[model samples]
Target chain A: MPHDHHDHLSPSGHPYRPDQDGPLTYWQAMEIAIRELMVEKGIVTAAQVREQIDAMDARSPAQGAAFVARFWTDPAFRDLALRDGSNACAEMGFEVGPMRLIALENTSRLHNVVVCTLCSCYPRNLLGLPPDWYKSRAYRSRTVREPRKVLAEFGTILPEGVELRVHDSTADMRYIVVPRRPDGTDGWQPDRLAKLVTRDSMIGVAEALPATEAPA
Target chain B: MADFAPGARVRVKAMMPPGHVRTPGYLRGRVGEVERVLGPFPNPEQLAYRRKGDPLDLYRVRFPLGDLWDRDDADTLEAEIYAHWLEPA
Candidate 1:
């Protein structure tokens, strides 16, 4: 998608600085010229970049939802998923690169929220790209200092006595919150149960919807 | 660093090395219990710079929210930090 940089970039080709009085700055023009030269020389192809982007765009929270649904219905699968999330995700045919994937279980006594204080590192294969808010300065700073308040902002009001556990995704380790299965989901199949799990729920900002609210 | 198991008291070293570090600045110098050892992994700090290096042990440490900040109402904070940045509490 050849997006219009008009809104984000100044005429000078800088993001905000418009000191130059040209449509494209010298560096910007040089970049385009070099890119065209490379493509003309068959050094790199534009198709390759688009293909990578399309692959990324194809991933969504549905993958994580499927894993959670399986975990909810099968105790053995739950053990496997909890023990090694990377392996579980791999079994489902998702490529989670090399990082230790840990599934944090949210029970009646605890709630888990994942964040990367330094950068927005996430399980992109399972959960798609990190949301804008997840990468914001406000979230990165406030989550550790005041988790309850942050959760409240996300409309996730925890019950009294439940300790909110914030997991800082600071290293080569990723986290996914396997929220406590909602009540009244008895005998629910994985497909039916998957509908109740949302992206935010897997991130620990919300809970799985009640079965009644689930889609038919 | 290898034998640091769950329930072990560990403190995040206050030292701040230059260049890319995955450990958050806030948790530095804080004491916490090792919730779980997350297994040995390549040193991300080195890997990030494209340097091949040996793996380092990583652990999931849990710190009390009250201890990290003045807010008594905050809940616990857990983070996965590399073993090199930790010490016996």
Candidate 2:
């Protein structure tokens, strides 16, 4: 009786249905069919698909943090990033693919925030997968209409004198916000400065952590 | 060749065609200035249909928040719009 009772439960003691175990949806079926067809036709091997997936998964906000940290400490590198973001990333050994990259600098007088009103087009190469909220219908529709309100909800309160610039990633170009360097970190090393660069800061939802708040 | 140079005043065409488009609906018919020329790129409208889309010049158009909405601040919104979607303002 005990064994019979446990038979229906998953290892975690809940009756869970994994995606593959459940009935396949239309899109899932299409994907599987196309993948199989491509593999059968020798267009791409299964290993290649998995390798690409792993490559994408390997990218993370840390890459962006490193780039931003370098930008804060090195003037020459900052100029390169401002001139050509894609090339600058490439120089740092990060592959940005074919999509154009633009660095939006946040200054004392200006603030920049990015959103894709149409779809969730992001700089996946540099920042890894986007957070679910970025792709939500609420974010897509509301960011353009009331950006200051949206930013305020994220705890990013801009001063009245600062101008907020919202970039809608509608087409080919991808943007990365170069958050202003925190005060009192003038002589900080790149490695130490990188710890202050959070994913939201690079995305422009927040600012870099102040020197006093730097993690131990 | 590029039709609009940087700082040119351009307006998004007001037409709403039923197909894949990169231009956002809210920007249609709105006026903005060309912040910069992003050079030629393949048209997504044609590429979405699996056709060989000829390249079109792309521009970073900057719109004042007041012009797009009922805001009184100096905030702005910028979007990458293809050449076909813009007309001289």
Candidate 3:
């Protein structure tokens, strides 16, 4: 489909003169020109183009970290997280709305899990923005096909006896992998737990950092 | 397609359209190789913007570590890139 140029460019690029263009950088002019031409000819409407742009422009959820902390404190809530993942968050006063959230827990059965076979479908509400590498094609294609090799690059080479399951997220729904808090963080409070469930854990790329280790 | 093969060198024009779904911001106008050409794809990016119905041509570009970014990410491994051509390369 012939889309507007502004859509493909990422947040890294900002306009040269923000005072006039609202800090919007001309990341790529060719794609944008192609899109504007199509719109000018009535092939597509500006309203329709904006609709998709709006979805991309959606903000990260506010309550995500709080919910992760809630589950960390309540063993019962953690079990609920294992069951229907969204309900667990909702019970703790967080909602995903139309978007879905999948929970990948590190358990005895499996040590780690992650998403992205084709594209990046992260848990925006729980996790803030995705890392730059997540948006890169290297991470997108390698994570699912070679989870072990890719995980190692992230400094997470698994030990013997741990099984890795890679998940592929579609355009619909978001996913979060609850990293089992490290051994040192036993008596930590919910606030501390919130700190533990870093964005990497939510992406299933890196496990949550212990209270001792800094948030990834 | 002169001497064009998978893993050959190419660079994208430093231009973007208004409603396109493209590679992330950090990867514009960078040079890389044609890792694997995915042929034509149903462009989810253009569709996401509610754009036209024309299918996109996909190419998997492989770039060396020293080329894309300079970091201690890993000395051994290489980076892979993916993009769909809007017109001809």
Candidate 4:
């Protein structure tokens, strides 16, 4: 039997679920009502809503990886990112909406991790939608209180000398952890270096992939 | 005008208002230093009620993990807190 990819997988390669086919949730019902009202009232069109969804769906971790790669290779950009994350991302052609972004740099002595203790506020415009675990109650509650334990759950272990800094996105500001560039990629270009910058690394769950492990 | 400047010691006010408050429960009454003054932004509490929230000064406060928890490590935690939820410590 031939396996039809379209029937089982979404465009992003994740398994597709028949959400609309299932019993409509309360939130989904409310969303439908609001969208219909807005469209009927000429506030917005269905086309515009679809376009917005398409725009958001287009964003992914690849964008953040590119920014990290640039930050690693360019000294001036790195300084700018540390000073003003929004502007630095804009300089790289990624518009991060209205929310203020703060770039946390990981050094030999310090490691930075970001979590939204109050809610699942993330740098969505830069890194796309957060993973399901990021929005879980356990992650939101424990990451601030027992971050070392949470990092260990993600298979990340730091040395005794390295200090960990957890940035809780409690309010309006969003955060991005600039994981330290791996060794042995001294003269690698940003495009190549981006392959080593994984999504988990940017979230501070894990370090950047080693230079030797970068995709060929 | 900002009430607290960067590096100023401040404490998260231990308030439990039953609305859209941004201050986390664990941080209430906890003391920390203002890492930076992030300028005024619309207060989320008021905005949640569909009111035009008057802008409030927001600050990044850094607390030592030991102070936050019973941990022996030297890790630290930073959170963005609105000025209204903070008091001079």
Worst ten-residue run, lDDT, model 2 chain B? B65-74
lDDT of 3 by residue, B1-89 (tens): 22346756777556675654445433456666664444354566667767764554455454333444554222111222334432224
lDDT of 1 by residue, B5-89 (tens): 8999999999989998888888999999999886688888888799995688889899999998855664788898888999999
- Fnat for each model: 0.95, 0.97, 0.00, 0.97
What candidate 3 gets wrong by more than 4 Å, as runs, is A1-62, A214-216, B1-89
What does DockQ come to for candidate 2? Answer: 0.89
Q: Is the docking of candidate 1 incorrect, acceptable, medium or high quality?
A: medium
Looking at candidate 4 chain A, the ten consecutive residues that score lowest on lDDT are: A1-10
Tens-digit lDDT track for model 3 on A1-216? 233466553455543333455544576577788789999999999999999778656655335666767667888988888666777767766655656455666765565454554567667656655766888888877664466778888887777566665554533435676667677777778876776666666666677776776454
Q: Isolated chain A: TM-score per model?
A: 0.82, 0.85, 0.67, 0.86
Q: Which stretches of candidate 1 lie over 4 Å from their true place?
A: A1-44, B71-74
lDDT (C-alpha) at residue A33 in model 3: 88
TM-score of each: 0.86, 0.90, 0.52, 0.90
CAPRI-style grade of the A/B interface in model 3: incorrect
As a TM-score, model 4 comes out at 0.90
The TM-score measured for candidate 2 stands at 0.90
